[model samples]
Target: MANLAAVVGIGQTKYTTKRGDVSIAGLVREAAANALEDAGLGWDDIEAVIIGKAPDMFEGVIMPEIYLTDALGCNGKPMLRVHTAGSVGGSTALVAASHVQSGTFKRVLTVAFEKQSESNAMWALSTPQPFSVHLNAGAGGYFAPIIREYMRRSEAPYDVGIKVAVKDRLHGARNPLAHLQKPDITLQEVEESFMLWDPLRFLEACPSSDGACAMVIASEDLAEQSPKPPAWIRGVAMRSEPTMYAGREEVSPQAGRDCAADVYQQAGITDPRRDLDCAEVYVPFSWYEPMWLENLGFAAEGEGWKLTMEGATSLDEGGDIPWNPSGGVLCSNPIGASGMIRFAEAARQVRGDAGAHQVEGAKLALGHAYGGGAQFFSMWVVGSEKS
Candidate 1:
């Protein structure tokens, strides 16, 4: 049987459009240092290092892990790099956890970062590739139509997306590290915002951010010895499918459903809405909040939008299951690091360390991320108890 693993430390750099004070190496190093400090461990304590990020073009740097090894204190230790588009962050953390769970390492450090300000991310992601269609522009162009499709099928109120935009921005105001701070954002402001992509308004879409996230995963024994409370890894799962296929359900991809199902089963959860205290899902666009609620089994098909309308996912509204107390990707999107931010925030909730945004007495939480035309999916369930 595999050994148990948990998150002993979590860290994140302030999310913003540009972090001119530091280079890419410095960006990641800052987060890594914070994670080590939080864990009360030194560089020598980390047995292995794993890093993840978006494509090399996003930062104009190829094979960043090679040069970053020394910065992360992995000079003579094993180092690995993981890439799964936007889902890279969550998957990278999972890989680090597996190293300890599989009895291959006692303690491991995982880092994910994206300096989008340094490079033209839209151009990098939209560049023509062989055998792939490029009819759409960047992510907004690709996902806008999908959102429309979901709206048509679900017949959800048009204001649902607007409500999510305001709610998450309000949530972001409470997160000191969040990129956008809209303490008093209103639905009227969102409704009046210019439409970037039909249904997606300027405020409804996530901002381009330059930031990083890091975590320290340790074996059960090491986790128990840590100074801070550890968020036990109850379950972790990843799934993927071809980006383009005939009859593909882009609204709620099957890969996402399977991944969520797998993780829920491992965590012994039959009803996510009732069993989980909260969720930090990857929702770069406001509409994705309800879309993912259904995909993750938090709501029945075609009924997810109702939850948003009823404030079920709002932390400040005293909802039953708050979705993004840390403001989620909608408020801070560093692409590669966004997903891991979700995972880290979930851990923070369970550890009772999420400062102003903490869900009261949260014992279990969910973290989720999806990327690559919504084909790549990664998720994890975490809890305060080891069982």
Candidate 2:
């Protein structure tokens, strides 16, 4: 009693460090309106609304969905909110797809945003929690040791991270909505930048941006009537583990591996590297490009770094399976919206809607996001042809 779901519309705001011109509600409304326009539909066409964001403490606004409904024209429609730390965006999109796939709704709107301009995410992240002792200062501090361990196990060169930073930034330069436009960023510059953590440089980390991303998901019948070609949802999966657990593998978390395996199986992908034309993975830190490359089965365990060094993931480098052609989180990170942006970008690629960063002949794509000590994992597969 389930049906197919497809993304009929995708929208994103111009990511930046601050958006002083609009309130948080206004920011989300802008993205929602854009998505509605892209779908060639009006507010009444949507039957439900799902919104997501990081902690309200990040913005000092509690229960934002109550007020956001009005801005989204969801006054009388069913509205829901989902949260999973940084993976919230991807999870939100999956939830919206579920409503359509379950045959409970014909169409739904999903949006995720983060107004980091008014919120101090770093401060909130660094705060101490009751059960966990956070010896690491910030995200970088926590992930640095894990990255170092991967380097030791893989024996990757020291410049592999630098190469990834430059590659993603170069990809970001092609995206007009990216926050940090460094088309000319060099590996030497990244290598020389100040080291925030033991192995992560200032340039190798993602920027805290203020923006939102929205998507319109519709059932098979509604999607067939869309004005634009639909990116058919092939599969979706989510998995989570405790924040800190004994004998946990932080470098390549089991949750992430299992989630990818589940989604790929649903999509009938026996080899992610061969089946997917491109990918938009969550790589907040530069080293994560290689780490996730392995975790996602793009490469063999210790050989993921070799793919990066060979420019296999670079769009401008004429790589076959380009990753993050839209610049990715390294270029613009709207916290709660980052993962949705990745999912949307993958859809854009499959629909042949990605402009300058378009992966040629991209009929299949993968979008992935992870959070909370790499314990939370969400992934989806999309294709031009419905599965």
Error of 2 at 325 (Å): 0.4
TM-score (C-alpha) between model 2 and the true structure: 0.98
| lDDT per residue (tens digit) for residues 214-259 in model 2 | 9999999999999999999999999999978899888899999999
What are the models' TM-scores? 0.99, 0.98
Which stretches of candidate 1 lie above 4 Å from their native place?
A: none
Model 1 weakest lDDT span, ten residues long: 127-136
User: All candidates' lDDT scores?
Assistant: 0.94, 0.94
lDDT tens digits, residue span 234-331, model 1: 99999999988899999999999999999999999999999999999999999999999999998999999999999999988889999999998989
Error of 2 at 198 (Å): 1.5
